[model samples]
Target chain A: MVAHATPKSNESKPIAALLVAAAVAIVGILIVVPLVSVFYEAFSRGVGGWWAALADDPDTRHAIWLSLTVAPVAVAINTVFGVAAAWLVARFRFPGRSLLISLFDVPFSVSPVVAGLALVLIFGRQGLLGPTLAWLDWKVIFSWPGLVLATTFVTLPLVVRELIPVMEAIGPEEEMAAVSLGASGWQVFTRVTLPNIRWALLHGIVLANARAMGEFGAVYVVSGHIAGATDTMPLRVEKLFQEYRQPASMAVASVLAGLALVTLVAKFVIERRLEAESRDLEAARGLENTRLEATRP
Target chain B: MSIHVRSISKSFGSFQALDDVSLDVAAGTLLALLGPSGSGKTTLLRIIAGLEFPDAGSIEEDGEDITERHARQREVGFVFQHYALFRHMSVFENVAFGLRVRKVPSAEVTTRVEELLRLVRLEGLGGRKPSQLSGGQRQRVALARALAIRPKILLLDEPFGALDAKVRVELRQWLRRLHDEIGMTSVFVTHDQEEAFELADEVVVMNHGKIEQQGTPDEVFDRPSTPFVMDFLGNVNVYHGRVENGRAFWHGIPIDYPAYPHAQSREARVYLRPHELEISPPGAVANRLGTSLAASIVRVTRSGPITRVACRPHGSEQELHVDVPTETARGLQITLEPGTHVAITPRNARVFIPGPEYSI
Candidate 1:
């Protein structure tokens, strides 16, 4: 029998080879080289210099502390909001449902600086709710809360966008089945719906965390960049660079860069696990066929 | 338990899904809701299971009104068309889900799950995930999970619609046997006529959100009340004809119509099942009572034990289809030639006057 060339095998064509090489070259020049240079510049004076630059600088320490405190709180809030929003949007119908879903993606489409400025326009001392805020003695812009608010706005769509498709694809059948089998509303969610979407939810959280930690443009606009107070990690790196502290700047930048690499690896690992799960499911189906064939007389 | 649904009316947007429909199911009897798509059979089943509430109706179970009860409080088992098994859990856990949610002890859950698995013939296969099983196995697992709760009534929506043909037949027979073994009051919705006929003692024929007829399978097969029920039941040949003097006549062939004996010649339709027709050589049978039509053979197909013959009548453009046993075809010397003359006689045919407009 003559063998037909499958699409996977066709990837060995010369055109595919050329395209792959071109992609690798572009990635090396654009992404890999800059990344390597950042780490190289950070460690130029040695590991001891890197450590001292991070520890000896009080403003850098405060910025790091501030970032740790702010992003997680935003993530936690968005986690709750993500599940609720995804469930509402995926499982039910109401007025303006499509409009509300598209509205959730506003942060993604609007510029980060624009979102930050919009927040400032709303809650800043002279903006829409400025009187209410000032009367209540509440500080929003140029404070830790402003940082949290800006970070949350930037990462709002990540968790929700990830979960909506998964939940919608699952549909209401399993929940219906669960309820008909005598499960309460909460039991249907935790026992049936949550398990079905847990991987996607976790995947969303990971992406949200990465975006939360790395958000800069919006934070730069809202934080006011006060040293040892409102300045976050990205803002601190920029401050160090402007003060001619190149190696120290690169040191702090490398930490952020390292966190990004860690997130990349984590994302890659999670995606691989997800693929493995679906592949195992398909493989099980294929195994059933082969087992049936083997048992046939 | 007996279930009574009264005056159920439901609408989705402008589509009237169920319009003032009422029905009753006897206790310990298997009933099949038979219909095509948009017939509201599945909707009625969901209302009974409390997954959906009727727009204006009340549902009663065992003489108690439960229309306002939530699905979680209904204690009814529903198996979805797609088997809706919890994909992340093992088969054992999927079956044990209902018991566990009710806080049944772990030991009892294990024993009950094992028993249900064995009943479904999946005793050793309980360790696998739902995705790890074949379509038939997955459906059986779903049945086990639904049966795990031991609810008052069981509802299934096209349970075997996903399986291959051979497996579907096997599952159908097995499901009937299981129904007999358990004898729980069950109602299943199906569009497959054979499945409905073979599985249910009582069959309810539905069309356009209304119950056309409800009776035993034999009663419905023998006496379908409406044209929709007759057409939906199986493949039938329809002829444009007329009824006069208590007889239905098509091409000078008088069909038996004892029910319509009025001396009125009006436009009517005659429905004849393919298997109910007998095809033979012309002038062979004594043509008494005008029960025969003269036709030429168009084509004959032999498949297994059945032979399907297509014949077109002389001096007419219409064609008649007849199904005969292969042995009987040989006995009658039925041929596949397109121009050979033959006679086709319907053993029994239905006659109905067409309304102003008949929507299939």
Candidate 2:
């Protein structure tokens, strides 16, 4: 004979299990499907062709080099402007503060295609100051300079948006303490303010760099996708796909995907490090509380 | 060095934070700005530290004008109530921060940093980050960091306000000893009367953005200048009264005023500290039974050696609590229960000219 069991009140086990399964299935379909397909296509191209695509191909080499070079430069430029803009928005009360913040919405609002087109119109031959640029024997559009500019514009908000909350959270007390300790403005910025925001700044850099490497539309229009000249990995993949070099395209695509994967892992590691540091800090504070309590008379 | 501030007043938009406050700090002495919240104690401290600008005032450090100087240029050391330790830096690094900012030699920084860490009793913890230290330890690191530069003045804004009761008392004692050892001209802001009394060489009592009075702790505590100061620094029983010649009268009741100033017959207020109120039987001979009012004991609280008896007058709506030696409460012979009859006689009450608001 089997005994009947009673279920507890307020415990909807069936619905909870169903919800968890549904959430997991949704994530698997949305992310895992395409990721697995991309990997299968890139690596399944016969060992000889895979090696050529990975190492021996000239176009692959150039695209990989261009990507490595341009992304870091774009991220570097954004870091400076981002820190400055974040500091202004966080620390100072000034006219147009709201307007300046709303400007960050510009990158997110406009489509990347529109951003590329806008860059073209401004720096193109018939655009404003186009004739002056031509007279100076310098070209702005359809060049590496144009690529960097467009990439920087699209990625500028990443660092600033990340840093604003961080800087605001730190407030002015730490810096003020440093100042009262005879630290100059620069010293305070470098020593006190910067260290507190370092994690946020690093997270922002990773995000900006990821976006820069994957950028296609703006860099495509601006660089003209010149073979072995301004062509980056993403542009090279597009070119290879157009040319029906399936194996080559997949190889370079895989490289780009691989870079993204590596950085994604890096981001996770840093996030974990930050979490551990915060937990350690909490534990230390707890210990302090206990010690204080113990020593109380 | 000595510092002088005269007539400092400041307004942020429409809120007046500091108003015409003046204070003078002698060389090599610690001063405490004591007040309740929003009484401008912190504002006055910040103004002297150059962290704030006064709308109207002048500041002089060692007879030299410094009102316009920036906080960094003022060459002062400040310890915040929260410690404000740089979390990323090690204890040694934090102590060396001010020196490093000044581009001191690396060797000199090492020596000074070590010396400061030892001074704060954190000799072995210099390698640990602030995130790794106890709150009390972090506060010491912050103090050491501030002192690393050896500024002409030291400033602390409620330095131990964040600590627990026991730690606060201990740190106050430690701070006093440190001050004596260093001979640094210092100013600290606090709202705790006990802390101010224990720590400051001189106490400045402030009220409503103005310096109500300033003197040694004993002088300020024993003889407060205004009704606000008397009410703020300790528990007091105030009475609405009038002064005529050298005598003070509450309603139609008169009391002998030996030290009462000769003033016109106008409405005045009298303040009597709780401990000054004596409990006596009816028709008992006492100092001066200004008014005999029957009161019933409402509550009794025993605090170690003292017993506080809270009573409400039988015919009036006012309630007063008087603290007496615990032994005295037992000797009363009668039950001091609720509705018990007792008389309250004012032993020493100071009179003041009444104000429009908060008169008595």
- Best-fitting candidate, scored by lDDT: 1
Off by over 4 Å in 2: A1-29, A54-61, A280-297, B241-248, B255-267, B285-292, B330-335, B356-360
- DockQ for each model: 0.43, 0.43
lDDT tens digits, residue span B301-344, model 1: 78899988888877788778889988888787646567888888
lDDT for each candidate structure: 0.87, 0.82
Per-residue C-alpha lDDT of model 2 across residues B1-360, encoded as one tens digit per residue? 999998999987778889888789999989999998888888888899999988999999999999999898998889986677787888898889888888999999999999988888999998998887767788899889988988878999988766777777888899889888888899999888888998899999887788889999999988887888898887887777677777887534576665556665766777777788778664543333447556778987889888888888665677787887888878975666666777777677787776664443
Model 1 RMSD vs true structure: 4.0
**Real contacts recovered, all predictions:** 0.66, 0.65
Which candidate number would show the highest DockQ if scored against the true structure? 2
| CAPRI-style quality class for the chain A–B interface of candidate 1 | acceptable
Model 1 error, position B321 (Å): 1.7
Please report, as a residue range, the 10-residue window in candidate 2 chain A with the lowest summed lDDT: A1-10
The 10-residue segment with the lowest total lDDT in model 1 chain A: A288-297
